[model samples]
Target: MREARPLPQYLVQRYHGWRATAFVENRVWYRRLADDGQHPRAMVIACCDSRVHVTSIFGADTGEFFIHRNIANLVPPYAPDGEQHGTSAAVEYAVNTLKVAHIVVVGHTNCGGVQGCHAMCSGHAPELEEKSSFVGRWMDILRPGYERVTPLPPEQQIRELERQAVLISLENLMTFPFVKMAVESGNLSLHGVLHDIAEGMLEQYDHQAGGFAPIV
Candidate 1:
């Protein structure tokens, strides 16, 4: 096994800076959170892309949101085969234990995972098509999404595929028994959103309209 090393100097300096400022200023709140435990009202499943900051976008406090990040913000269909499933585990915990009122899947523009899925589905990414490739397998969850946008132009397909990631995850979330129960009983709500990094725009899926609309 590879030995772990200490944090890089830059990260250490940033940690120290945060500890001195944010941590010190909110010491009491932090302590309260430690003692009381987190009671986040929403669980946000967002892309692991560094630019998509879920907390910053919502202006959320430290314990205000329970967040999970994965490539392309994809959530696979409900599979209970006794295998290791990180995204499913997080969803189960959030719904059953945390009892969060909201579950939001946040997809973003220019997602590498989405682009990879497009390439793989188009037979251009042989490396990702290999069985040994984890990302390739993970992206297989979005294959249906790719099929939905096949008639579009290549560039448009990529853009639509990004939104489809959010829609697919939202649909997959309903496959989870607990999530479905909560939504049926009006205890939990599901939301899908797309964030355009460069344009600084956010569009939310509209169930009635059957497409996404700006939050305005």
Candidate 2:
């Protein structure tokens, strides 16, 4: 086994500071959470982009939201091929085990993964089309979304594709039997949100309106 190295000084200092402040200040709350385990009411599937802060977006406290982050916040269609499905696994656990009432798939503007998918589909990123590229394979999930938005102007395609990522995930969530049953029974609700990284604005998908509208 490879030997593990010590954490960097900056991270160690940050940990110490957090431990001394937030951890110490909320010792009892933290202890209660540790003892009882988390029972978050909502599950947020968000992009792996560091700029998209799930907790901060909702002003959520620790243990309040079950979050899963992945490239472009995409969720592949339900496939039981007996292979590892990290995103699907998280969705199953959140819906079946945690019994979360809401599942929110959050996408963001200026997503690198989405841009890469656009490039690959547009034949601008031939390297990602290689068989060995994990990103290329994983990005197959967004191909349908990209196809649907292909008619738009070049400048608008990527941004629309980003929103489609959220919509696609929300649709894919229903592919899971448990997720479908929960939604059908009115026990679960699915939401799609797009975050504007530049303006720090949030737009929510309105089923009735059939498009995203800025939240106030």
Candidate 3:
């Protein structure tokens, strides 16, 4: 029988390496902010992708962005649906306690979650339904986006899916009363960012330019 420990031996070894690294670079940050608490300038809603870490992509220093990540970096609309809502709670804490000024819904290209959603929606991948996985429910968040791009070309459809996912998450941010009040009062602002992982490029939504612009 396997040891009842949560981590296997190799994982434990890698974690030990990470811990040693944490002791070096992260020590100063943990000392300064851990006792004082999280005071970040921005709150980033990012994906739980192995390649899309917000801290590393933006080169964030300690406590730079209060991050909330899920399968697809979703923020479900605020509702008393009798479910444990970790994302909503984190958003609330970021807005109410940390009082962060910016909330960025950071989406990325070549997202497998988005791909799964598109494949399921198009009805070509019926096998996805057999797994009884959270992928089904998580992909539901992209329903509105799916409806918007059904008739477009394959390339444009995928782009629309990714872009709309970010915009809808931005909309969901306003479902929280505190987030709404903060944005309305100019205490907070919202953004939709698209990160291209393969190209290692970052794009920011430029309202004036009417599209995404490369990070300068």
Tell me the TM-score of each prediction against the true structure: 0.98, 0.98, 0.87
Query: Pairing residues by index, what is the TM-score of model 3?
Result: 0.87
Question: Residue-wise lDDT of candidate 1 within 68-174, one digit each (tens)?
Answer: 99999999999999999999999999999999999999999999999999999999999999999999999999999999999998769999999999999999999
lDDT by residue (tens digit), candidate 2, 83-172: 999999999999999999999999999999999999999999998999999999999899999999999998899999999999999889
* Model 1 Cα shift for residue 196 (angstroms): 0.4
Candidate lDDT scores, in order, read: 0.96, 0.95, 0.84
| lDDT tens digits by residue: candidate 3, 1-216 | 675668788999998898789767778778888788878999999888888978888799877888888867778888878888888889988999899999988899988888888898888667666558677777788878889888898879987788778877887888888889999999999998888988888887877997678888
Question: lDDT winner among the candidates?
Answer: 1
lDDT of 1 at 99: 97
| Model 2 error, position 210 (Å) | 1.0
lDDT of 1 at 93: 93
Better of 2 and 3 by TM-score: 2
The clash numbers for all candidates, in the given order, read 0, 0, 0
